[model samples]
Target chain A: MLISNMEIIPGKQIQKHFGLVQGSSVRAKHVGRDIMASLKNIFGGELKGYTELLQESRDEAMDRMQQQAHAIGANAILNVRFSTSSVAQGAAEIYVYGTAVILE
Target chain B: MIELTIFLVLMTLGYLVGQYAEKKHYQSIIEREKRLSGLTTVASRFPPPGKQHDQCLVLGSVVISVDYFKRFIAMLRNLFGGRITSYEALLDRARRESLLRMKEQAAKMGAEYVFNVKYETASISKGRQNTIGSVEVLAYGTALMRPRDEA
Candidate 1:
């Protein structure tokens, strides 16, 4: 399905609007990854393990959003947006929302 | 005396390993950013000027946590109310890295441009510790794919 964050797609026409669709997920760091992160924190740079965790969470959230859009028979999701929060220690929540629409 | 020794050892380990890892990460980020330079990313809500083809949503997100040593240093800095340079660098790296990741995703999808980019960040708190343990940064945008014939 075609997705764009803009209200209008460059080459596509919006035939119908499906209001808003959303997907969200919460994930916690694994003990092993946490240990590695702590070790890496001392010298301070990029935390590979945590980066992977967040990326996975975001992808899953996006996938679920796409599924919702598909359920509503949307050929595209428009004006997509993302939000993230740390729900707890070592855990994060990723939420994505967008307008589902039929494009032609 | 033994406690001091242990602290010193841990600090030293953190310093050495953290510095090495950070340097390596910066190198990799720079290289990847250069490689993905062709895939233009912009924060404007409007799309770039080009012959547009197909479009899709793309995102990149990352979570990073402070190390024990940095946290300790930040805690001390809190008392003095000056710049926490360490955490500053960490956040900067996270933001840039996440943006680069989004571009990489767009490129993988055969997009020539990524527009309307947005960013969100959250601080994950634990228990009673006022210190921030970890942070999550998300970057997302629309990837514009041009027609193969346009090339």
Candidate 2:
């Protein structure tokens, strides 16, 4: 399904709106990754392990959102947004939401 | 005495390695920024005036952690309650890097301008006392995809 943050798609037209659809995932850092991260932290740099983890989590969340859109018989999601929060120590929650719509 | 030695060792390690890492990151950011200069990024919720084109959602995220030395310094700074330059630099880098990544994603999707850009930031904690272990930055926007022949 097509996904965008713009309220209106240029080529396509919105035929029907299915309201809001959302997906979320909560992830925590493992001991091994944390060990590696701490070592890298001594040098101050990007934590590749954590980056990869978050990326995966985001993709998963997006996938779930798509699934919701598909279940609702919508062809697209619009005005998509992402939010992150620290739910626990070493853990993060990612939420993605958008309006499901039928595009033609 | 042993504590002093460990602190010295960690401080030197942070100084040497952190400096190298920061330099490398800065160079990388500059290079990417130059490469993506063709794409426009704006914070306004409204799209730029132009021939209506397609639009897509694009996002980029990054996580950065401070060095041990910087954390230690920050802890000390807490006592005096002053701006921590070390953390300031770390956060600045994270923010810019995430934006660059978002631009890269938009460019890949054949979008010329990224509009309605937004940023979300969260701090991951490590200890019970709420010590910030790492910071995550998420940048997202709508990319206005124009016709390929418009150029």
Candidate 3:
């Protein structure tokens, strides 16, 4: 299925709207990675480990949202948005939502 | 006394190294921004009309941690109730770097324009005593690409 953040696809039209479909995942950092991150914190640089971790989580969330759209017989998802929140220490929740629709 | 000495050492190290890294990053960001200026980015909710193009989602994210010295300064600023310039710079760098990375990805995919761009910022770890440990910035957009046959 096609996923986009724009409200309208350039040349296509939406036939049906399935409202909002959302997915979320909560993940905690590995202990080893945390140690490395702390060390990096002293020097104030990018945390590659955390970046990869969050990216993975976000992709997973998007996949789940796509699955939901598929289950509802939608051909595309539009107006997609993402959010991240700290659920607890060392753990974060990646949430994504979009409107599922059938395009013609 | 030993703890105080250790704090001082870490603060000095953070100040010197963090400043150097920030300068280098800014330089690189500026250079890349110039190179990538051709890949236009916009926050409009819809793509321009009359173009039949393939579209896909693209994103870039980064996590940046605060250095010891900067964190200390932020703490002091907290007491005074004014702008935290150190953290401000940190966030500014993170935002620009994230957008650049997103543009780089779109360019790699042969996209000519990015639309509906959005940004999300989250504090990953608050650290002990309520200090921000690290911040994550994510920029996402829909990339409009020429049709395969045309490109």
TM per prediction: 0.88, 0.91, 0.96
Across A1-104, the per-residue lDDT of candidate 2 in tens digits comes to: 88877777665668999999999999987899989987887777889899888899899999999999999899999888888887877788889999999998
> Judged by TM-score, which candidate is best?
3
* Candidate 1, B31-88: lDDT as tens digits: 9988988788878887755566677778787666666577778889999999998788
Which regions of candidate 3 are displaced past 4 Å? B147-151
DockQ of predictions, in order shown = 0.58, 0.66, 0.81
Best by DockQ: 3
Candidate 3: count the clashes: 0
Model 2: colliding residue pairs: none
* lDDT per residue (tens digit) for residues B4-63 in model 3: 999999999999999998899899999999999999999888788887999999999999
For candidate 3, lDDT tens digit of each residue in A1-102? 999998998778899999999999999999999999988888898999999999999999999999999999999999999999998889999999999999
User: Candidate 1 chain A: worst 10 consecutive residues by lDDT?
Assistant: A38-47
Query: lDDT: which candidate is best?
Result: 3
Instruction: Give all candidates' CA lDDT scores.
Output: 0.79, 0.86, 0.92
Ten contiguous residues with the weakest lDDT in model 2 chain B? B124-133
- Candidate 1 lDDT over residue span A23-100, tens digit each: 999999889987887666555555778777877887899899999999999988888888877677778888889999
List, residue by residue over B1-151, the lDDT tens digit for candidate 2: 9999988999999888888889899999999999999898987776655476777788888999888888888889989998988889889999999999999988888887898889888886655456565788889988888766686
